[model samples]
Target: MAQIVGIGLLVLLLAFFTVFTYYAPHGDKAMGALAAAAIATFLVEALQSFVIGDIFSLGFFQEAGTEAGLLSGVIVAFLVALTMGVNPLNAAIIAVSCGGIGLIPGFFAAYLISFVVKYMERKIPNGLDFIVVVIVIVPITRLIGLLLTPLVDASLLNIGNIIVVATEASPILMGLLLGGIITVVGTSPLSSMALTALLGLTGIPMAVGSLAAFGSAFINSTLFHKLKIGNMKSVLSVAVEPLSKADVVSANPIPIYVTNFVGGGLSGIVIAYSGLVNDAPGTATPTAGLLVLFGYNPAAQVIIYAVIVAVISGVVGYIGSHFFRNYPVRNTDFD
Candidate 1:
């Protein structure tokens, strides 16, 4: 309960921070959406404690973490529609794709950057070398979890030996300490999803709600952006991409970025509570991190939650792009 309060406070502060930062833009809609997300976090947590507990088994936690990813898909939907400049009437497509393929953009964008820079590296002319970022590309950011997974079991073993040596002095503290040590060992960031499975602690349904809100907003953005769709043309033969060109979808990524954080984080917290942990050795990131859930035997509520997130993501992305801000990319004067 207290944690929910803490989360609400953080979201509120974040909301103010977002608005203050955008003071020049003064986006009332964007600001309002942030406020809504904060309120949502509070309501969802409270509901999870009372209603979900009354109605369903906590066994749903097994799917919480995976479920969170659905909301992030909205961000993907927003980006895709913005990039293509498709019209508002076509939002359904954006919603569908975002729900279906939200993670591909980031992963592929990273891949494209890598591929292009690497290709330019060998082909750069001597005088042109400085002008080109031929070598300035790295795809797939490394995750900390991947590198540290090996030491998990061995470290636990060493701690167990230490506890054995201390047992004669004060067994209670030693036992307490031992329990603490094993708990840490069991919940290693890389391994907790599986550990949760072993413990069978089906957490409440906070995570599913998180997923639902995220998906809802994402779908909302997608549909909204679709409604505002336009087209673009390059004035220059070779494009001079800006530092933040990644944001130059047919619309901007600002709204989507904000949406992803709120939506994604909520989903993550829910997953943690739900007892769903990603067991894959590598960092559970990108879509594969969560979409992997589709493979799991999810609680019935989670599937519904996913569909909702998809719809919201599309809707939010659409409205956010068209209503709040206009993109320069959609208005290039090629002539």
Candidate 2:
């Protein structure tokens, strides 16, 4: 009964979050900030602490990366507020208030508080607004973050537990589902990085997500070129970062999505078979995800799996392009 209720609540919360992202003002930007924060913090840690520090035995890089990871909530809140057009100083204050919380909770606090801060900016008059924000708004925002922290953490933890159990039960199947869906999200406005962070994905699930995303870069580039959906620059950009060519992908969803799903699923199977683990959440990005894999697994093993996934993804893209060769596509510009 409790499990059913938990599932129901998770669905409801996800639905609300989805609607908020679509309908709320600057919602997409706020979520984009989440991805940016993850890159700035977690990705840095993956590269610095894991790769540089652990591999090279350097204390400085390790300490710096660890510190950066600790500031995840601060960075997230700050960026979210700034993306919502809050004053820089005020954003810093909101970020500080959200200190000691996790990423998702910090985002919620900052996102909700940004509106109040905006309202006060209008009502409190120009010079006085900063004072009011520091005095009244800061503490309130912090309080909200503190209150939401446990709830958000608990919810994400539950979801993570479910994923862990599923992975244990059947890793290959979970890999297929997560890899495909997350790669699709990687190509969408909703960002795979943000989704993985929200779910607090770790272990094999994170491995699947990370590698699947890396493999998608090849898949997208190959598919775009073969299908003649965009120019050379756009195709290259999609390979580096699919979101850069989101309009093109969105415009030609049938071919792009199908190819990504197929390629990412194959890559997921490869990852699952290898049993590679990625402990870092939100590293479900291409370059960073690949680098982070080195942090967790044997370098040679990681390389072999990555190469296999990339090659398979490229082939999938090639085949998909041929299959959709005659299908009507909207060739888009880089601009």
- How do the predictions measure up, each by TM-score? 0.29, 0.74
How far off is model 1, as Cα RMSD? 17.6
Off by over 4 Å in 2: 1-18, 181-206, 220-262, 275-283, 292-300, 317-335
> Which residue runs of candidate 1 sit more than 4 Å off their true CA positions?
1-224, 227-251, 262-275, 281-290, 295-301, 325-335
Reference-based lDDT, each prediction = 0.31, 0.77
- Error (Å) of candidate 1 at residue 24 is 24
Against the true structure, candidate 2 has what lDDT? 0.77
Q: For candidate 1, what is the lDDT?
A: 0.31
lDDT tens digits, residue span 1-335, model 1: 33234334433533443343244232322222222222222223223322343234463542443344333323433333333332332222233333422232322232223334335545865445424432222111112112222343333334334444534444433333322222222111112122222222222221332232334334323423453322222211101111111112213334433434334333433333344322222112112223433334365645654554454444444555565455332311111
In candidate 2, list every pair of residues with a backbone clash.
none
RMSD of each: 17.6, 4.8
Q: What is the lDDT of residue 225 in candidate 2?
A: 83
